[model samples]
Target: MRNLLNFIIRYGRWFVFAFYITISCLLLVSNNSYQQSIFLTSANLVSNSVYTGASEVTGYFHLKAINESLQASNAILENEVLNLRHQIDEYKTILADSIELPPVAKRFDYVQATVINNSVRHPRNYFSINRGAKDGVKVGMGVVDQNGIVGIVNVTGDRTSRVISILNETQHFSVRLKDTNFIGSLSWRGGDPSIAYMEQVPRHARYQAGDTIVTSGYSTTFPADIPVGVVMNRIHGSDDNFFILKVRLNSDFRALSTVRVIKDEYKSELDSLQSFDFSPTK
Candidate 1:
């Protein structure tokens, strides 16, 4: 206790001086309006800078979520635009039919769906989407993206659906050459996602490299004239009756993010009407 008293006695004057200096500074700022205003401004600026830096760091960490939200929103807008375009085409068809009495035009609707999982490296590949029966998705519905037709939905649940991708070897789609309208069956060879084989194209048909291939609308899933791919190459079979042409697909399966599920409102009625002609003549 005596030692502490001696130390305090030794430094007491310096401590008193330091305390008085701090009190004097506070009194001067409080009494002087200009000095107080400057102090407040400086403190506010430093506080604002710190808050901005923290906010920027937080926002940087949230970029991925923001981008995903934007992609989902974009998917909705894209579906709406496609729907409007289809409506316009329908109106045009109606006008043309009224004038010339042509065949009835087919109609289609699209439901926006996000791709939850996809695979492009498998022989029998399938993709899953974030929509199902609860969202009006059903089996046999066609799935597509902005580029072109993707696949057909095969399995469905309340909130999820599975699609048999066009890249699958077992999945076949009917397509026609854009230039000659020669119909052929499109199937994958389990090679590459960007390539498929078009079979049963007659040898006599005019075949050209780079000619566009499009959906033939033979199936109730995809609409007519939807682009599928372009002819990449052609090879003749042993029988020489038909040519197997290579097609470069329009949709890039590796980077798929969003897609649309096509709903044919009149599919059941059409199927019922066409079911009576199933028997073939021998």
Candidate 2:
């Protein structure tokens, strides 16, 4: 208590000066309209700046959720586009007869997932997503990003799944030339992440620089017309029967953060065809 008294005695004059200064400023602002307006304006600016900085920090943390939501919406829209493309072509040729055909079912849906692990510099590259069998991500389901194709689900666990990336040399995807409707098998040669090779194209298949290549819909994996890559050029194949076109993939594997797993509605029924009981049995 004696030390406190000494300390106050030592700084009492300075404390008085500070107290008077604060009161003087407050009274000056309160008594003068111009000073009060200027004070309020400066205070508002400071408050706004603080609020803006805080809001930016909060938004940065929520970026992942926002991105995942956007990717999910985009996947749904892309699926709808594919279904519409199929329906438009079919209905345009109808003759308006009372033909009660089966209703065209919605063929695709998406499961949004984050790419937790990824690779591009390997002979057989694979990536892992945060979704699994519990999320309706099954083996052989197609994986895609907003830009284009990513891979196929290879193995699935209860909460995670690995995908055979499009860059894998052992993996081949059925893709078609958008201009020619010529279907081919897309494979990678294990060097460039951006490049792949499409084979089984006819020698006379018309292609120019930057021709679009998309899913052929011949497989049960990917839906029809999902973008795969763009043709860069053609190379001489070992056999003269087919042309091998070099392609630039649309998805940048290095930048894959979020992806969508494609769920084809008819995939199970289509896959069950091979196991159908056809022989005369009991």
lDDT of 1 by residue, 165-235 (tens): 89888788999998566999999999778999999999888977899999998888998888899998997
Error (Å) of candidate 1 at residue 278 is 8.6
Best by TM-score: 2
lDDT of 2 at 59: 34
What's the C-alpha lDDT at position 111 in model 1? Answer: 91
The C-alpha stretches of model 1 lying farther than 4 A from their native spots are: 1-106, 277-282
Q: At residue 280, what lDDT does model 2 achieve? A: 89
Please list the Cα RMSD from the true structure of every candidate, rounded to 1 decimal place.
23.7, 20.9
lDDT values for all models: 0.78, 0.79
**For candidate 2, lDDT tens digit of each residue in 137-192?**
88789999877888988767666677789988878899999956788999999898
